[model samples]
Target: MQQSAVPELAHTHARPIHWVATATAVAGVIALSSVAQPGSATAAQAAPGTEAKSAPAAAAPPSTTGVTFPLDCGPVKAIVVKKATGDLDGDGRPETVAVVHCDAPMGTPPDGVYVLTRGADNPKPRVVATLVDPKDRRTVTDFALRARTVTATLLGYSTADVPSCCPDLKIPTTWRWNGTAFVRSTTATAHSV
Candidate 1:
């Protein structure tokens, strides 16, 4: 995957979102793949032999189209808040982090992460913070959020391609979401461990 040139995403965050196609916003049109659609429910309960009006129920096919989205970079993440810490900004004070993580959506387009942290000035309610990946995998080892300050480790963004959605073309580049739109961040080979 390649890195995107868009800098706005330098301090943004990314999230894994599932877009379901209804009449409005649909993740994508899912076709038959391994998982088969189920039969429709009979409407004979309410009225004797009334034809069912709803569409046939289909089995949720296994997530096939694995999306390849880029994430975790400079300005790419506005701020990463760690749970368990009572404060965000330093100075023996409590802070509320408000970020616009809109880039969390899937795809090479740079997404944004909108985060909001709130606390009080007097006898504030200390909220614990815990950050993790889509797989619920723990990332931040341990840290504290002080007033106007936040500390954490680097983010390792992974692809969310199911191959089942857009099988013909699985994005080969690292796509990023910069708050409002998608941007190619960088190629997977650009950086190394």
Candidate 2:
């Protein structure tokens, strides 16, 4: 064997102490990396010479709590079955569309859909419009708020002879605000269930 020019280094040989020191250094590097993280990336870039202005926080939709609905439930209290929120009136504030019905013990009670909004003058949420009245004997299903429009599948009876327990007709309906009032438009003809 030929003799090497450089002297044998202690680090060249594998030792328990050397392994422990290397493991400790690796663990320290992992811990430091975890502690130091990059900031979140954003797509929007501010123009030069102009300060970036953060967008104003949007107002929360009106809540159904503490708001009295126009329902005449003799004994049972009115309960909110389903709800959706969106900007309906183009006022930047969101409105809550709630499907409310009497908490009947036996039969399926009819549902009433109401649009609720909180005005600047009044802090409490109030029903601004009644999309579906309970007196109409329609049950709201598949309800949604999309693109400032309220859409729903209305389950109703074809005639008075149809029992309340089962709805025979299904109608897909949508309501949109026209600056004055909410105009209701049925997307499809009523069909048998």
Candidate 3:
């Protein structure tokens, strides 16, 4: 069954980030926009050495796994979180919504996103997916997230380099978050959706 997306940012998933408006992703070399020290999804573990988020955690965090490290992006460089939401699981728990960025100065590299999620058992933050702007047909931005329940951007990015499948069909795809895993929704087969 499909439900309202966790973020509630954009109801539809057909809209993409308007990079031109902000002139944000200027195709520059990737760099560390911000460093988010890891946190324990569980309430038991106190954040002693973890990096602090701009926002404080309310109540208890969900269990989480560790994020993938040393992520290779062919030519992509440092992957960083651009934007994120707090709750996603709908258990009165906050899920993470991260906007990953890549590309920077010379030798910096291209850009990509590193999404993380909190699990119930592990308690450590887990890398959900690393998204890259699909600038080519052979290569498209594929999201890899923990899958607890995710809501992707609806706007077709002006410069995100849309893959053949995304634009051709031009629809929305829902990812179902099972307690233990995530499953792609098959309700709409709009080729793009």
Q: Largest lDDT belongs to which candidate?
A: 2
Deviation in angstroms for 41 in model 2?
A: 17
lDDT (10s digit) by residue, model 3, range 35-108: 44466577455488986556746645423233443344556554454444444445656555444444444432
TM-scores, each model vs. reference: 0.20, 0.75, 0.36
Model 1 TM-score, all chains together? 0.20
Tens-place lDDT digits, model 1, residues 1-193: 9877976662254433322224224323344332466777884565767765876553221111221222344445322332232223232433332211224334332222222233343232322222223332212322333433343332333334433223222112222224443343334442212
Q: Largest TM-score belongs to which candidate?
A: 2
Show where candidate 3 strays beyond 4 Å.
1-71, 90-92, 99-115, 118-124, 128-149, 153-167, 191-193
Candidates' lDDT values, in order?
Answer: 0.31, 0.94, 0.44
Error of 3 at 51 (Å): 33
Each prediction's Cα RMSD? 30.3, 6.9, 26.9
Q: Mind sharing the TM-score for model 3?
A: 0.36
Instruction: Mark the 10 consecutive residues where model 2 has the least summed lDDT.
Output: 184-193
